[model samples]
Structures are given as structure tokens and as C-alpha cells.
Target: MNEFTLTADFGMTASDNGFIQYGIHPGDTIMFKKAEDFPVNGSIVAVIIDDGPITLKRISFYGDSLDCYLEGGSSRVAPIFISHAEYGRLKVLGVAVSVIHSLAPAEE
Candidate 1:
């Protein structure tokens, strides 16, 4: 599996709701299977936009578009829909398997 360190929150935002207790904080390292190495359904994935920085997201495929969710999986933020026409702009690198949590607390 390939790994990458997070430099931003991505979709791992904090929540006051008690049901959502965990999140991938910045500085956490994520291990993921390469896109071609694994099948991606409704799984947490690493995504790159226009060759930009890699970030974490939960992705699902619809008929002609893709649905991308944030940390809490639609509970916190609305999904970003990527239509078939925009497929070239973004790419899914892989499916995230695990996260190495950072020991230090996050800076506010």
C-alpha cells in the first residue's frame, strides 16, 4: 500500500455531534491501495484535483457522475458531484485503508 501525509483537514472536520467521534487530523499519515490495485465503490479514497494536492474523501459512483463526501460521510458536508464531463479534472488515487494518527494535538 502507498502512504501519504496530510497537510490539510480535507474533509476531516470537527463536529459537536457525539456520534461522530473520530477524524483524520492534519499530519496523520494515510495508507491506501493504489487506484489500479483496488476496486473503489463507496469507500474512503484519496483524490487529486487538477494535479493538485492529494486529499481524503469518500466516493461513490452514480450513473453519469461521482458523489464525494467529507469526513462524516454526508453528515457534515454536502457531497461534491463530479459529472462525467468533469472526470478529467479530478482523479482518485486509491482507497484509504488506515490512518496513522498524529500524537501531537492539532493547532487551532
Candidate 2:
């Protein structure tokens, strides 16, 4: 079998309280790929926006709105609303495949 290694454009800083159950934390490096590689309304993906800051959320398309929200980690958090205009610069950056964790203890 041929192994495909997709090159990542950048990494996101995940929050500890957000994805601790998934073993992802604030210092962890989450690799990403070009948006073209993944499907829209797919699973958890890292989205880069030109008008707003980059986000790590589950993406779902509803007409012109891309519904982005916390999937398994929280209930109180609200979903982000992005219209088609925002998607003009939208890039999936691929789905989160794995995380490079920062195992060092908290700083003093």
C-alpha cells in the first residue's frame, strides 16, 4: 500500500479545557492541509478566515452559512456563523489527523 503524507500549511493552538478528553491541549500542534483535500460539511477541520481569526471547529454547510461549533468537548459553547462572503477566503486546511502534545508541566 502506498502511504500518503499530506504537507501541513500551519498549526493551531488548542485549549486545554476544550479538548482534554481528546488529549489535545493549549500547547499541542495540530497539523492542517489545504481545504481542497477535504469535503465540505465534513468532520472536524481547521478553518482559516481572512476576516476573522483561525478556528478549530466542526464545519457544516447550511445554504450560505457554514455552521461551526464545538463537537464533543462542550455544551455551553455557541456555534460560529460564517456567511458565503466569509468563505471567499475560507480554506478547510484539512481535518485534524493527529496532535503533537506538549507534555511539559505547567510553568511557574
RMSD of each: 7.4, 4.7
Q: lDDT scores for all predictions?
A: 0.57, 0.63
lDDT score, candidate 1: 0.57
lDDT of 2 at 13: 67
1-108: candidate 2 lDDT, tens digit per residue: 998775776677675556666667767877766566545564668666665666777666675554443344455566666665555666666777667777885343
lDDT of 1 by residue, 5-85 (tens): 654332332222322233555555666766764345667777776788765666667754344333434356656766656
Off by over 4 Å in 2: 1-7, 37-42, 48-50, 61-72, 81-91, 106-108
Compare the candidates by lDDT and give the number of the best one.
2
Model 2 poorest ten-residue lDDT run: 64-73
Query: What pairs collide in candidate 2?
Result: none
